[model samples]
Every structure is written in structure tokens, then in C-alpha cells.
Target: MLISNIEVIPGKRITDHLGLVQGSTVRAKHAGKDLMAGLKNIFGGELQGYTELLQESRQEAVDRMIVQAQAIGANAIINVRFSTSAIAAGASEILAYGTAVRLNDR
Candidate 1:
């Protein structure tokens, strides 16, 4: 399925609006990874572990959103958006949302 941040897709016409779809996930920092991140913080360098965690979380959220869209027979998703929030001291929630639509070649 085609996905984009823009409301309109070039060379494609929106044939049906399937409504809004969303997916989200919550994740916490692993103790081992957190310890490594803390050590890296002392050296004032990038926390690869934390970075990887967030990236993976984001992808999972997006994938879930796509599954929802597909289940509703949507061929594409437009105006895709992502949000992140701290759920707790060590946990964070990631969300992905978009308008599901059926498209046809113009």
C-alpha cells in the first residue's frame, strides 16, 4: 500500500475514503540496555541501544496501522502522522495514524 505524509498522492485519485486508522505500542527500556546507555552517557556519546529501541517501536506502530488499513480494504494511507509520549519514567508510547483510502490511477 502507498503511504505518504502528504494529503494528496500525485497521479492517483482517491476513490473511496475508508476513514481514520491508528496503531500504537508501549515499550520500556531494558535493564541491560539501560545500563549500557548510562555508561555511554558518562562518555557523552550516542546511546545506540536507546536509539534502536525507539526506531523499532516506531516501525512496529506503523506496521500495525497498515494492517488496520488493509483490513478495511484501503489501498493507501494519506496524511500519515506519528507521535511519541512518555508513559512512565522508563517507558514510552508510540502512535501512528492516517486516513485510509482507496485509490485509482488518474
Candidate 2:
């Protein structure tokens, strides 16, 4: 399905609004990764481990949001948005949300 951060999808008309859909996931840091990240912190550079973790989390959240949209028979999702927060000391939560809509093919 087409997903966009904007309210409208170019070249397509919104036929129906299926309302809001959302998905979220929480991930915890791995001890080994934390150790490596800590070491990297000393040198002060990109934290690959944490970066990878957030990437994975974001993907999962988006995947889940897509599933929910599909289940509601939506052809696309508009105004897609993402949020992240530290829910715990070593854990982070990622959320994906959007307005589910049915769109004209062209």
C-alpha cells in the first residue's frame, strides 16, 4: 500500500476514509551492544548498535501499522507519522500511525 507523510497522495483521489490506524513496538538494548556502544561513546561517533536497534523497531512498527490498515481494507495510508520514546532505562518504544483510506487507482 502507498504510505505518505502528507495528507494527500499525488495522482490518486481518496475514495473513502477508514479512520486512524496505529502500531507500536518496544525494544530493549542488548548488553553486548550496550557495552560496545559505551566503548564507542568514549571515541564519540555514531552508535551503530543503537542506530540498528531503532531502525529495526521503526520497521516493525510500520509493518504492523500496514497490517492493521490492510485488515481494515485500506488501499493506502496518509499522514503517516512516527514517534519514539525511552519507556525504560534500556528500552525504547516506537510507534507508527496514519489515517487509513481507500484511494482511486489513478
Winning model by lDDT = 1
Residue-level lDDT for 95 in candidate 1: 98
lDDT tens string, model 1, 1-106?
9999999999999999999999999999999998998888789988888889999999999999999999999999999999999979999999999999999999
Q: After superposing candidate 1 on the true structure, give the runs of residues whose Cα lies further than 4 Å from its correct spot.
A: none
Task: Give the residue spans of candidate 2 off by over 4 A.
Answer: none
Clashes of each: 0, 0
Model 1 alpha-carbon miss at residue 76, Å: 0.4
Candidate-wise lDDT, in order: 0.95, 0.93
- On the 0 to 100 scale, the lDDT of residue 5 in model 2 is 94
